[model samples]
Target: MSNESSVAAEQGTAPAAGASHNHNPSPNHTVSKDTRRRVVTASFIGNFVEWFDYAVYGYLAGVISTVFFPESDRQTALLATFGVFAISFFVRPLGGFIWGHIGDRLGRKQALSLSIVLMSVATFCIALIPGYATIGVMAPILLLLVRVVQGFSAAGEYAGASAFLVEYATANRRGLYAAVVPASTAAGLLLGSLLAALLSSVLTAEQLNEWGWRLPFLLAAPMGLIGRYIRTKLEDTPAFRELAEKDDGVKAPALAMFRTYRKQLIIATGAVLLNAVGFYVILSYMPTYLSEELGFGATESFLATTIALASYIGFIFLTGIASDKFGRKRMLITASVLFILLTVPAFMLLDTRNFLVIVLVQILLGGMLTLNDGTLPSFLAELFPTKVRYTGFAVSFNLSNALFGGTAPFMATLLIGMTASKLAPGWYLVAAAVVSLIAVLFAAETSKKPLLQD
Candidate 1:
């Protein structure tokens, strides 16, 4: 092949002889359809398990506060619970560096397998910790410690899974494949919301605080085992394997990312701001917001969120497909613009406190979010070359998430208290959207191009 042909082949405009449509430029490394199916499954499950644990924690934050903290003041206890939640995220940036090294240098499979086990173990441990009555000050302390482990483990899951799927995907359908990450995440949240609703309705407050909250967490053990087994059985992604074969993989991926790709790192971190805030605020924290802040019934709040999450899962696949057709930058920009124009109105609708209207508004917010969330994994994956893809994605993603995303719920509550306004979270989301819009404007479109392999 001539130099132009080689470049064209790499860009997917032309193919090297015998290179499968489902594979990249490396003809010898064609990924079979069966393998692709399995890759999707393996990539989806670990993220599912990781987010399920997080969803359960967020949904049960109220019960956990009462169980782990002294109930001298309701607001104080709830703030303490969310404080532990936010503090745990501070460990994620460090985890990003560690897992990025493993994924970029060693293998994506290794980092994913290890992270899932640690996440599940820490989550399962949360179920066994004694309440404040039995453990005194140790209860909250242990809760925070376990949450930190969970946060650290979860740091690697999203970036590794996104990289694994995108590398294995056909160039034309990478967006759809990458959307599986957010879909699985929403699935986990849906299950958590349903369980929360069920327990809150069927069990008395005493029962929920004493024992019911622990039940969902115990499922993490078997789920982790299964996620690990599936991930271990798979080989590394074709991109990683190709890099390894060429001996071109980076040795110090995190360092290289900072030194070589500072602009991409900055853009990626900024672009993630909206996802970090919107995800936590819309999907994870909304139930707490509705029930606690709006004085809605817990069961009703969970029901509304459950309905929204279900719609979100469906909307995600469509957004993924759309990104493949329309381009990621357009879809992302659309999401940001929509959030800026409509978030305050959405929150205004929620303040009316009507059950049906709240459900509609939540669904609307979730659908708008799909435009951003569904496209983000692929966009982030495309930002860096194969040499440091995992590191770049993880570090930038976790940095934004740690600083903004993890703190969103706490910030929302604090803002509401300080401003004496019910619309505080809405304003926060708008600001996040503006930041992301500016970042995405700076990004180059990667949908029509092939994966970068350096």
Candidate 2:
């Protein structure tokens, strides 16, 4: 059967009822169901492990501050910890170019397999590092070194996993398939939150600072091995394989992307701002915000974020399905607008300090975030052709994330300190939403389009 017929057969009555279909014969149309399942699993598990480490680090930032930094003012130590976090992200843009080349020129699985090893190894090493009391200044230096390695390794994960899933997805269901990326990401954060909450509740502060923080980082070794093994067992994405057969693959994908797809790179980078801010601010940073900023108990703060993450996982898939039906642009724009309108109010509610109210506010913010996070992988995958897809997505996503996403917690803390406004983070998120709303408005709708090929 022809590719068009195959897409129709897979989609059933939806296409028959006047839905538009792409005329090109996409390799994605021929991916077997079993292989697709494996693709989703590999993509999901790899990303899950990568983000789980991030979640643990972010959730335990308070404990980590005291462990690594010199004895100083509490706020000063916290700032130092977050500084390490932000400084590590500075390497992501470079990692994007290097990993993009490997993914685009060599193979997605190749890059992913190598990156997971580096990420897991670096994270596991953090478990063995001596504390400030043991090694003085050298302790924080080791933490910074490990974090930079993690930042570099993580640069490729989201973009590569998205490309892997989208390239293997059916033409009509790419959004739904790609949603697995963010869902798995939240799954990782959820586990980290639960672990963090449990540790905080049971362990004394000295015990947590002295040793409990190391346990989560230790899990990264085995988790990384599993993720790497699963990824290596799978073949490269069909899109990358197809591109390799066409020629030798792009010799310099980053240079080619710069020359040929600058416009797409800009839009993608701008569009990612909302996700960068929202993800770090809403999901990762909120635990610290609630506890440190609002004076909530550590366990309660984590409980709030944990509940929100659970609800977020459910909302993400629904947003993915909605984007497939309605459009990527609409879902993205809606998310941005909601943040602009409601973020300040959500922060206001958090200041109320009621546990139940805090949970509801977190859930509300997380739900708003789902529209952007769930839809972004597919939207970005559709922005470039197979030739530069990996490079384009990786570079743009990481560039924006490096500048805005990773620094969000630092910025939020600094903003409150400098401005003496608890609402500073809310305004920061609003500004990001406005930027992204404008950026996405310029983007072309790609939901129903075939994955582009050279």
Clashing pairs in 1: none
Clashes of 2: 0
lDDT of 2: 0.89
TM-score of each: 0.95, 0.94
- Model 2 clashing residue pairs (backbone): none
Q: Pick out the ten consecutive residues of candidate 1 with the lowest summed lDDT.
A: 14-23
Question: Model 1, range 286-359, lDDT digits (tens) per residue?
Answer: 99999999999999999999999999999999999999999999999999999999999999999999999999
Give stretches of model 2 more than 4 Å off. Answer: 1-29
Residue by residue across 220-291, what tens digits does model 2's lDDT show?
Answer: 999999999899899887767766765736688998888767778888999999999999999999999999
Q: Candidate 1: where are CA atoms >4 Å away?
A: 1-23
